[model samples]
Target: MSGHGVALRVVACGKTFADGTRALAPVTLDVGRGETAVLLGPSGCGKTTLLRIIAGLETPDPGGRVLFGDSDVTGVPIERRNVGMVFQSYALFPNMNVADNIGYGLKVRGVGEAERKARVAALVALTGIEGLERRRIDQLSGGQRQRVALARAVAVQPSVLLLDEPLTALDAALRERLRGELNRLLRTLGITTIYVTHDQAEAMALGDRIVVMREGAIAQIGTPRAVYFAPENRFVAEFVGAANLIEAACNGATLALPGGTLPVADGALHGPATAMIRPEAIKIVPAENASLIGLVDSVSFLGDRQRVLISAAATKVITADVPNAIALAAGDRVGLSVEPAAIRLLPGDTT
Candidate 1:
């Protein structure tokens, strides 16, 4: 709560190992004051490398500079950077109780007993770990342990908070619950947080902007709504969620699918193109009134909605989510309709 989250800048930053393997290509990005920016991608995508560079745990290649606001901190060490880091593992000290663990950073910095106790108490309350201050690390559950770890990290009020898959170790239900809690906490603390994860849901939930990476380079950077609704590339569309990719030729009016033609918007010139439709975008209507018809390969009831997998809607199979009370089933004939604006045309032909 007392932290000052500054703007972080990475200019021409890149990483390479001693063995001459380039871990990351040169890149530049900015994390604005009090903003949460997520580095999202698969393993070995250089997300962690960039995070370490920002945290001062890993040195960038020459000519790369990491700046905390106006001051260049490229030569600084991790301890001197004033950063709070939380990892997938709850890296709390086993011998220390919760109070001592939370106050360890203050102790290391030689803060007086009175000040350390006050700060620890504030953090303990902030992280909802008040009643467990006297408990040992072994006495807490996975969620509680993570809470303590986060509290310990924030107890020092670091300038930037770096979290690397902090909630991944917990079970599914706990992970989800903690994600919402963490999002609220980060916003409440007003900390400039940089979270790294391969989970799209986590990125969507927490990030003010997501930096999508691939093969040691950045693929795209945008807000959750921008990335989800208007993906820049085919990889982004497919990776973020289930996308119904329809490959067809455009004649400036409509796209010709195997089943039928769907209306198209402008800017999709005469050439080979791919259209991406999200599962929720495609509507299931009566066969005669629909734009295209397909046989329902499978229908799965998912409480509020039903997931219908189309065996053949076009050249590719399409997955659609419709209302649960549609009375649809596998082996049933169904019609699919989609809004023209919802159909996003991707450039080039990877068909």
Candidate 2:
């Protein structure tokens, strides 16, 4: 489908409700043409609010501005903004068949009946729902319904697509399958898209760039690799992935952990920092090396890897992912060593 190409620019965007609750604060973001940007954060962190502002469903505060290409769209209404939205509920019309549902927007725009039918047919084929075009909403499975909703959203050939936790209702296996399909479809369509989700895994898997939002503000924005491996702060590190944060005190050149003294990277010897390490970054060894002695508290198998929970200090449990072949039961003593370069230091105030 062909339509007007557009890029989005959100400049100093802020959102505050009449009840005096500030949903988002002074946020600025730019989505390049045909790029997919994912807004990821916990609930009530303003990711959804920011998305609404972009969709023109929620107006930004006076100082903020939303631009679609060169036109300022902050004051535009939702329908006027050539954007399509997919909600968590899939929001299908129970009374309409898949073809009618997909063609509704085009019909409303006064397009010829023949053109609408042709467009809907192409969308049904694109979404792999040709036979199901006549099916009612209640007759479709969750995944099928989701595809219909997506097809409907794209039927209008929107310049920007906004999705709010669209796959959160699906089961784990189905969610994984559809996530891959959605990523491929979005890339093929090449529409500038903004997706909002609380699932960090989904964000990491789908986003060309992940924007990490904190309470009412942006914490960091980067590619999935940079956001996961080089988080700017402790909140981003812990929120994006499972980070084993060890308490450490910096002393010029080295960091003192409860287990042992870990050498700090050059110019990173800041005072009172937490050493962040991924569970997979910690290796299990039989001999005592530069390691921490811990007693295994619990072990659980997760298909390919075993999650070993070890206790190094009182009430402090460290998680490590060991290969399933390395059998170890609870109460077994082990040594855990991490690569020096894998350590990341964040301020102690990070929570």
The total of clashing pairs for model 1 equals 0
Q: Which 10 residues in a row give candidate 1 its minimum summed lDDT? A: 342-351
Tell me the spans in candidate 2 whose CA falls farther than 4 Å from its real position.
2-5, 313-315
Model 2, range 41-92, lDDT digits (tens) per residue?
Answer: 9999999999999999998998899999999988889999988889999999
Off by over 4 Å in 1: 349-351
- The deviation in Å at residue 341 for candidate 1 is 1.5
Cα RMSD (angstroms) for every candidate in the order listed: 1.4, 1.9
TM-score of each: 0.97, 0.94
> TM-score of predicted model 1?
0.97
CA lDDT of each candidate? 0.90, 0.86
